[model samples]
Target: MYDYVKGQVTRITPEYIALEVQNIGYQLFTPNPYAFRVNEQIQLVYVHMHVREDAHTLYGFTSLEQRELFRKLIQVSGIGPKGALAILASGAPTHVIQAIEMEDEAFLVKFPGVGKKTARQMILDLKGKLGTLMDVVELPSTEDELPLFGMNPYGHELEEAMLALIALGYSEKELAKVKPQLEEDEALTTTDAYMKQALKVLLKMK
Candidate 1:
């Protein structure tokens, strides 16, 4: 029933972000949790409610097209919310649409959890239905709101931000690629700032 949640990101983890909207913190699972920074106020999370026998969860997205594709992905046989999210994490919805259109099962099967059967099912179910998604899906921009540096000698904020990034689905190897740049920048002082900087490096990282 909820359409969106506008709030600050108060917490981040490997699978979810806790967005505090009014007085309540909603746990929202997203494709790229690290794309957001902690405590940056006023973000709109386009949402979908996924209900199961034991619990209900909210899957959040940065844009309408992302949310719509997520919904569509779950409707296909053998594609659950988590599976759909892993596929979306590639940041290449256009490539996925093209693959489906082209019936390139190999490319589609390259995504995590997608196999030959699932790939063909996706093509069979969604060949021409994804044009609107392709036309509208664009990368959401991350705004670096603050710089966190030179505030403390111990670098606690940087440490915490690194842990948070690790929690936000970034591997240690991936963080190692950008850690030196962050270390060299003495301008980062807060976890949010470091998180923002880290996200910039990650989004640019191929």
Candidate 2:
């Protein structure tokens, strides 16, 4: 029922980020947790609460358009929260919209958990429906000004990126294939950078 939360990001893990507001910490599962930087200043995260029989979970996004896309994706058969997160994690909402609009099942199936049938279902269900979101959904920029944190002596950032990819339903085999390349890239200093690079690689592999 909650629409959003505004707070300082206190922790960033593979599965979620901890947002502290007034001494309370809200754990928000996001498409890309690494995208959020731990900061002193408050940031806004639009949220969707998913209620299940066993547990209630909250999914957060950097923008309302992203959240809206998530909502639309989950409405399709076979696309759950986790699957939707994997698609959004690519940080190319416009590309997704274009693929759907163009009925590009090849591009749609590149996302984890989306096979031919699901891709067809998505096109059948939401092709023209996402026209509104196409205009509003913003592409994620690499030039974020926020200062990155959570660095350690060891190669924790790469490990975290791998774990995050696993959480998004990528198999270890897929990650292992790219591990060596990611390790060799000195420019990937932060988890966010590693994640962005890894996703590009994985999408190419598809």
lDDT of each: 0.77, 0.80
- Deviation in Å, model 1, residue 153 alpha carbon: 38
Tell me the lDDT of model 2 at 108.
78
Q: Per-residue lDDT of 109-189 in model 1, one digit per residue for the tens?
A: 766689999999999999888757867434222332112112332255567678887877999999989987887775663
Best by TM-score: 2
True-vs-predicted CA distance for residue 185, candidate 2, Å = 12
Indicate the worst ten consecutive residues by lDDT in candidate 1.
Answer: 145-154
Candidate 2 lDDT, 154-185, residue by residue in tens: 16557878887897899999999998898787
**TM-score of each predicted structure versus truth:** 0.67, 0.69
